[model samples]
Target: MIFNSDTSSDQVQSEFKGRVSLLESDVKQKNCSIIINDLKEWDSGTYQLRVITLPRAGSSVWGKRSCPLRGYCNTLVEGEISAEAGLCVVIPCSFTVPDRIQISHIVWFKCESTKWRCDHGDMIFNSDTSSDQVQSEFKGRVSLLESDVNQKNCSIIINDLKESDSGEYQLRVIGLQMEDALTFSQKATVAVKGLSQRPTVMIPTLTEGQQTTLTCTAPGLCSGSEPTFTWRWRRRGESDTDLTGNITAVKTENVASFAKRSSSTLSFSPSAEHHGTNITCTVLFQGNVSTEETATLNVTYVKEVRITQNASVSEGETLNLTCKVDSFPPSLITWTKVSDHSSRNGTGTTLQNNTFSDSAQLREERGTATLSLFNVTAGDAGQYVCTVTHMNSTWKENVNVTVIYMRDPVITGNLRVKEGAVLNLTCRDNSFPPSHVAWTQVFDQSSRNGAGTTLQKNTFTTGDYLENLRFLVVALLLLMIISVIVVNLRYWRKSVQQGPTNTKSPSGFSNEPESLQDYDDVSNATARAPTSPNLLDDHTSEGEVEMNFPQVRFTATPRRQTTNRDSSSSHQDES
Candidate 1:
């Protein structure tokens, strides 16, 4: 037992010595400690350790001089950490060691990784380094709360903390043992955020002709400078306009933290024009820091519907129809062909016409609805109604599509005619606007007048008449052969009685060929015109018949009437 110091062992057992014990004095395994229940000021002293001697390999090596107990152990006291934002967060840090820590200078560094050690510095503060060595932004900002770092009070203070200055910070005592560096322990983390780090915007559904309110709250959660709020609107095709006149602004504080936050509410009657317009809330912070949040308004309304389609559509062609709907919050649009039977009913409107509704082919994009009718027939051509139902409003528009079709030109008339007959031909076609018709011979490719004598004149030609003459000539020649045969068959004795020489031709011996007018069956030239100018030339192709004075008939009576002829004995040769 050791007593309070009164000059050492002389008083070791003498005065009030009840508080000391050498409980673990066994030197064999080198275990020796002096336990103190409650520390007092007088207990801080060095005492001699005495034990029986033995070799290290033997029992009770407890007494070995080499294992004598002294202060050679290490210990530390670690403190808990807590931090705040927008305000400087102080992390109380203090540490103690069994051995006196010799430090040259204090250095503060910031690093995200705090494993094992923090050697390289984003050095924030260095007590011994030149002022230039510290980052300019942190030069005067970082400091120690306690001037005497040797006292192991490692607390620090950072003024005017920024959100960027949030993270783990490590303090290093340059001269401390490598294992004793504060970087070896879990680092203190600081988090700095604006009282309201992010702006809050609340917008609700707006309907046309209705009053609505939009609220915007600038960022912050704790007490501090209130931010200035401004409201603006951006409509398509229009410049941005400030809306502060309709906006009411008020400063609010969080009851728990006494943190200040700003809020602004805008009141307005919404119209269709305001639909899809951007409402921007800009918060101006201290130091000219500004941020903005934008929200688009969706106002619902419906207006007149515009329907469009091709005026002229070909039969069996696909019909393309577009219905433009001017409404916010796009609504359903149905395209239906209006029926002739469409009538008003008590329940609703119903179409009764022979209408084909292609509801499946309806497609809507943006505010326009498109419908396609496939393989349209002539019946498909009619009035198409585009009905738009948006919110509680309905709009309708009608489009008419006409199917155009045509038939080819058709020619019809008498095609068969006699060789010399007039060729009466006609061409006809049925069309919406009358079509041009013409008659042309397939062989000559000649066009004829529509309905006039001029066309008859063009076809009335001699070539056809000449062909008729060819037939007539053949028929007359056959008749002449028959007549000669008949003349040869009939023979009778005759006596000639001459009155005078009168063959002197009735017209003085004609030499020209006898005109075919003798046939009388031929076409009369005076009745119509000459079949052709060459008709005369064709009739004159035969040699002319000549007439001469008949041999002078003697005045003598018929003397030889019966001379050479006995009845039926001698043939009568009149040659």
Candidate 2:
């Protein structure tokens, strides 16, 4: 059977004229040609073609020989193809010839692997090969791969080829010749795979206060694509900035492998400000995918400051001032006196005796500035300012000073006093600032309460006799009474020792008998006189001659002794 490109199998017999009246068997085109340029797994299926034919006659003129005869002519042809995994293959197909025959229909089929059977659409026909005869998995993807359907080049291309496409493919063709009906079997296979995976980025360590360089390397074989590298820096309050670097690629034999490495160099004299800032490197691959790495920057800086001096001060006084600040470069120091005072401006005098030093040592090596003024006077005192310079910045501190004279404390009143006397001593001194008042005494070693006695009442009593006259007088009176009693006793004893007879004797008294004799003579004379007077008167008369003798005797009579003597004498004279 010969199939026309534009004709259908149902009208095939009338459209063709032949000697043999072709009776085309009604056979579905089980296999159809799948023409695919960009073949895929979905393009896999079975296909077929169909044809029909009719009888032909010849006639002769004038005497005759024209005859025509025909029998029913019919045919059917079928074939099968298959596919594999991960590969692209074609389905093989062909057709038989027919005289006065027109092949019009082609069809294809996929036998169910489990049932080993086919359905209606599986038995494809040419006119409706465009119909939903193919399996759902192979519907839109399967197509006619060849240019001419009449030639029966039923080869096809399948792509994105997968394992599931591996199956039996059958083809069926309908035509007029009875002997043209045949089935040829063959199979093909296809395969598919996944793409390559992405790669990782590597980074290095960075130190503070130095230049740091970071590189981001693209991972995997970047066959036909260029790896793009970029860097970003993100800090606390700052926006991100792109970091650029030099990029390069590596290759091996036929496979040109890509390695995208970018380096960003941050050259800075690090400071504390740079700390905790995030520096990152981002690498973009094939414009869609990216890899990144981040690092924290650490910066260091030294402390710094500045100092300045104040203007105008007095003389002869101390000025204390300071200059302080904060920074990184360890502040430098310098001193200058500002002489703006009206008194010192025209005068050729300068008050620059101020000294400078540091007091507190900063633990971070930070310290305090101290300005000292000694023996300051009105001219020496004014505005003294301290200046400190650090990190290109200058700071100044000022102090106003006025100098006044001071005097030592002077003792005003007497400080010495007797033990119990009231002490009133005053100490006074002259000074710019008044001096303090105080009282102190030089202590006496013998006094328990110290040398100076406070102002208070005092009474003294003397135990010495001379000190108390009444006591002395009483002692003298007792001595006088003792002496009087002693004198009286001695005199009484002397009186008792003398006798009373010795007390009566007279010094002129003599123990003589003259007075007694005189008295006795007188008494004798009186007795004699009485006797003699009478005798005498008689004898005197009788004898003058006897008178002599008698006179002796008369005398004896008056002074008996004398008279007797006289009488004895007279008598002796008479004898």
Top model number, TM-score: 1
lDDT of 1 by residue, 270-370 (tens): 88878878989887765456667889888877767887777567766777788897877686777766555552321223232234365225666888877
Candidate 2 global CA lDDT score: 0.41
Considering summed lDDT, which 10 consecutive residues are worst modelled in model 1? Answer: 490-499
| N/CA/C clash count, model 1 | 11
Off by over 4 Å in 1: 1-196, 235-240, 243-245, 251-254, 271-274, 287-290, 312-318, 342-363, 373-377, 400-575
lDDT of each: 0.54, 0.41
Q: In model 2, state the lDDT of residue 439.
A: 40
Put down candidate 2 lDDT per residue, 109-135, tens digits, no spaces: 656556344456554223345565555
In candidate 2, what residue range of length 10 has the lowest lDDT sum? 59-68
